[model samples]
Target: MDTRRILRRTRTGACLLAAVALLTSGCSFGSTTRPVGSAAAAAEEVPALTPLPRSTPAALEPYYEQKPAWRDCGAPGFQCATLKAPLDYAEPSAGDVRLAVARKKATGPGKRLGSLLVNPGGPGGSAIGYLQAYAGVGYPAGVRARYDMVAVDPRGVARSEPVECLDGPAMDAYTRTDVTPDDAGEIDTLVAAYKKFAEGCGADAPKLLRHVSTVEAARDMDIVRAALGDWKLHYVGASYGTFLGATYAGLFPHRAGRLVLDGAVDPSLPARRLNLEQTAGFDTAFTAFAKDCVRQSDCPLGGRGTTPAQVGERLKAFFAGLDTRPVPTGDADGRNLTESLATMGVIAALYDESAWQQLREALTAAMREKDGAGLLVLADGYYERGAGADFSNLMFANAAVNCLDLPPAFDSPDEVRRALPDFRKASPVFGEGLAWASLNCAYWPVRATGEAQRIEAKGAAPIVVVGTTRDPATPYRWAEALAGQLSSARLLTYEGDGHTAYGRGSDCIDSAINAYLLDGTPPTDGKRCS
Candidate 1:
């Protein structure tokens, strides 16, 4: 599945919901009452535990024993370091991959709680970027005061040995290629784009690409934990990071500490099912957006009382018109808004309700004023397109990690064609494009090394799994499924809209998670917050 930001920033930060066909990192709660009375009392009742004995293989002891000589990085109050991990765990003699790590020391009033690693998802999203932009500065003061905030860009991601694919111009072309093909020629162009992207990645880093799977990334986390002098890992992972966190817990159950998996992905799903479910999730989010849009004076969808399906029809018709007649976007690169870009523009805003007004204005500009600049901006944000030709390795790493984690969702156009009806049923507006998007991995250079399986993490400490009832990138069902699979997990529900719940103005979620991070107490399982 595609994964990126749990909390996307844009220009200063980046995107949230992964594009359909691309898996993304993206979570909810509300009663203000602290679950177990006071934080002080809860802190006093810290859980007793026996530390897990280090089981580092003799071949890999060097990596675990190494210490990072932290130094000042560009971002204030943050120290940066490079971590080394085995390129191939199966053969430690093989070269090494250097991971970029950053941290902000605890601002203490209470006893320090060791390092608390945070990953904002993106099978491709840069963990270091998330730490510096949001998690490091924006986390609750109580939690930040006690725990050293840390982040490591995963292998094949930004700051690490990033996996490069297409250059800026080529990537721009790829994004514009039509997904809803009307003819064989259009289909051929779409397929050619995917093949070129996969081929470019293989040519750039054949060896590195093979080793950037989730399993390897999880293993890297353990090495980081060891190097940081932490006995156990305390982490907050959102979106695809949830999958990574679950994988880590399963692999090193005893090393698992207080892990918060927000906007979780279900480890039990195959690639195709994951894509299908996410498409439906986008539709759910759009329905909510549409309902709200109709009540606004500037809404482009319709007047008050317009059914969501009717709004969707208007949008689909607009997209159809764009397929033949693209609109001017006033981009310096001369890039016009195509059907594909417009779709991405709309989807990006669905990640959080705060973006709805921006989307309304964007839609109004595009549909009513015939100016596509606003929608183009939204699309650019989703793709992490920066000034001129500059772009992050997010899409490249997104594809690399996703293609390796599970087999391709569809092997050929015929397979996707056959699956179209089910996908359309799941989401009439987004299904067709998303179904076509799922065909991306079919052109991967390397063979798949992993498969869909449940993560039990049997010996791990209590883990918290948070879900938003209407998260577009990661559906709520995924959280439920993951919680049921993990041996020691408590599912926290947010009856709300958006990609994730915590730190996005949810006091209940923040307090519960904060209490768990500071003390050893977890919210009661199945707690619902609104």
Candidate 2:
């Protein structure tokens, strides 16, 4: 899945959602699309991973037991450290990979409760970025005061030895490639694109690519846990990070302690199942957006009497119109708004409902004024592409981790063709494009190192699995499935619109998580919050 963590910031802390919407608001809700592993996609499982890699084995204690040589990070209060983990745990004698870690010590007069590790779900999102940007400074004061906020950039994410794929110009072409192909020639073009992209990563970082699987990352986390002097791990993971934490729990049940898995993913499902469900989740989000939009003056899709189904049809028509004659975005680079880009701009807003109004405005611009600048900005934001054209390794790592965690969702266009009807049934608006996007890993150079399976984490402490009813990236059903699979799981339901629930302006979610973090008391099973 696309690394699901909404990026923490931009040049403006508010992000480009508003600016983009004001320009591209004419095409809201009805036509959201991103590659299957978009920024809000779910994140993994493996067999050697099942028994739980708990105690430091005799052969590897040397690496795990090594003390972190901490140093001040140029940031005032945080300390940074480097950790070492066996590149191949099964063959510890081969080599080691260096991991980046950071922490803000507890600022307390109260008794310290050790460290609380935080992951902001990308499978690619930088945990260190999350820690410094939000968790360290914005988390509940009590929690921060008593527990050091810690983070470790996964093996192939930012700050860690990153995985590099297509560079900027190449990426721009790849991103703009038509996902909803019209014919076999277009299908060949899409398949060629996937192969080119995957080939770039393999050629650029052959060794690292082979080692960045989810189980390996989870194992890396265990080493970080031991290096931090914590016998047990306390973590709060959102979206894809939820999958990571759950993986860790399965891999090391006895080491798990007080984990809050918001936007939970069902580890048991394969990529095809996960991708299909996520598409449905986006459709659910659009329905909510449409229901809200018709109530407003600038509703682009429909009016008071207009049904969501009609809104979807109108939006699809708009996308089709873009295919024949692209709109000028009025950008300095003269980038026109293509169907793929307009769809990406729409997908950008699905992560948070607060962006719904912006989406409406964006659609208005595209439909009424034929301006595409705003939509382009949203696409940039989703891709984490800065105005300067520099991109983080988020998408690269996202695909690397995701592709390794599960076999490709479909092997070829023929396979996707067979599956297209089912996908369309799931998401008439976005299904075809997403089905094509799923073909990305089919061309991956390395074979998958993990498989989808239930993670019981039987001996772990009470783990809280949070779900949002209208969550677009991680379907609410996945949360229910995950909660059911874990031996000791509590479901915290947020009946709202968005991706994950822990701190999206919800007092109910915050309080329950805080109580769990501080007192080791989880909210009762099936607790509902809005």
Candidate 3:
């Protein structure tokens, strides 16, 4: 079992796919000391939410009615604006959350369609960043000609009063936390790390932390829609963005015009079930990587005759070797490549097949040459820790939203201990740590505001849900589940590797999506792309 990509959905920002590598497996390290008592509590499950109406709440009317004042920002063609949304939806007057918005007008040859909002799916990911960086410039020219490409930095994300937990050095320490604790002392260290992380977030963004839930973010999107003067939402959301898009559709079905939820998440799953399934998905990806790795002459995992199991064993052995003695990397910061960092680097490579060659090369250097710099670089990329030691708000906001979305996956170390075998059953390479990683939210200062529920979004227009058969992060089955859960969803299958399918060299996927977005023609149900 490999739980390398446990919280893959939340590791998004900039080009979601580029950040994909940095979304490396989530874990923090420990000092190998025991605590007086276990830092665990009973899991709290929120009652499932019924769909909210499209009608804006009276208190929120001001937010939805306000027009944005757009100005030239970033690139010459791009414009940026600030929009306001209620910090707390239920009690709208409590406060306000400001969102950053960006758009590029249609370069039209013909008719203009409505505004098209795009989110790349880090609950932490910056949607406005995505629009300015890629979708605004790279989407099909015809689609761009018709639609004003738009995005909003949902509350608590970058340039939107972004959440901050740990500073760079502290985050470096946090990422090194021992996820796979071998003893009570290790467990205590892990608990301390989680406490430190949760406390940092609480101290840094007390008010905004509780206000950044996905439900609120979706509502913020609606406000952005109205501010942009779009009658309905024309949107494309990838990875966790799919969850936000689905939440929008589920909440405001009539306003859900045309949407593409790529690399979908199953809203029906419990946090634990979701984590376990994701662990298995990573294992599936590692198995694929291993099978592919052995076929290459320079693969460090195994030779051509080796089986995937053998390769995994060899890799596991390598990891065990590093657990005690971290390999030295040429990092000026003196950051040696620990087992956690190296494993994260490997997980980063699993997101894209194109990176497999690089992984092989990195592994060769780490295993044969005793040089850990390449893997350390990959690990840094995954964490979004820049060469200058500056950190993005990505992971901070990722933890904030995910912790609020569902109850902690594991309430206690005992609970994790009980679920350990099953997690390992899901992924031998990365299982135990992920099972422990799920305990992260247990120490969250804010109680969870949401829970598992089926989102049929009944009465919504046809929504296209794209699934890649071998997507490592958002698994293929999640897309299937999401499509089935949405009343008018049309499933488009890409039987391939990597994360999301569209715009990643799959013409079939791109064409189908383009047709839906442009002509309102959904691809055939269960349409398959190679």
Candidate of highest TM-score: 1
lDDT of 1 by residue, 154-253 (tens): 9999999999999999888888889888888888888898899899999999999999988899999999999999999999998888988999998889
Which parts of model 3 are misplaced by more than 4 Å? Answer: 1-49
Full candidate order by TM-score, most accurate first: 1, 3, 2
Per-residue lDDT of candidate 3, residues 1-530 (tens digit): 12223223235321111111112121101211111121111111222335786677788789889988989999879999888888888888788888899999989887898999988876677777677767788789999999999988878888999989888888888777766777999899988988898899999999888888888888888888899898999999988899899999988889999999998887767788778777777788888899999999989988888998899889888888888888888888878887778888888787777778889999999999999998887777667677657878877888888888777777888998999999788889877766787787888999988877777788889999988777777777777767767889898888878888788788999999998988999998878887
Q: Name model 1 segments beyond 4 Å from true.
A: 1-54
- Report every candidate's CA lDDT: 0.82, 0.78, 0.78
Cand. 1 Cα-lDDT: 0.82
Per-candidate RMSD, Å? 6.8, 6.7, 7.8
Tens-place lDDT digits, model 2, residues 1-530: 12223454211001111110000001112211211332123332332246644456899979877899999994789999999898888899888888999999999978999899998876677889888877888898999999999999999989999888888777777777888889988888877888888898899889889899878888898888888899899999887788889999988999999999998777777677777777777788777888888889998888898888888888899999998888888866557898888888887777788888888998999999999777787788777776545778777888888888888787877898999998788877876777677778788999998887778888889999988878777777777767867889988888888778887789999999999999999998887877
**Each prediction's TM-score versus the true structure:** 0.92, 0.91, 0.91
In candidate 1, how many Å is residue 463 off?
A: 0.2
Clashes of each: 20, 21, 15
Candidate ordering by lDDT (highest first): 1, 3, 2
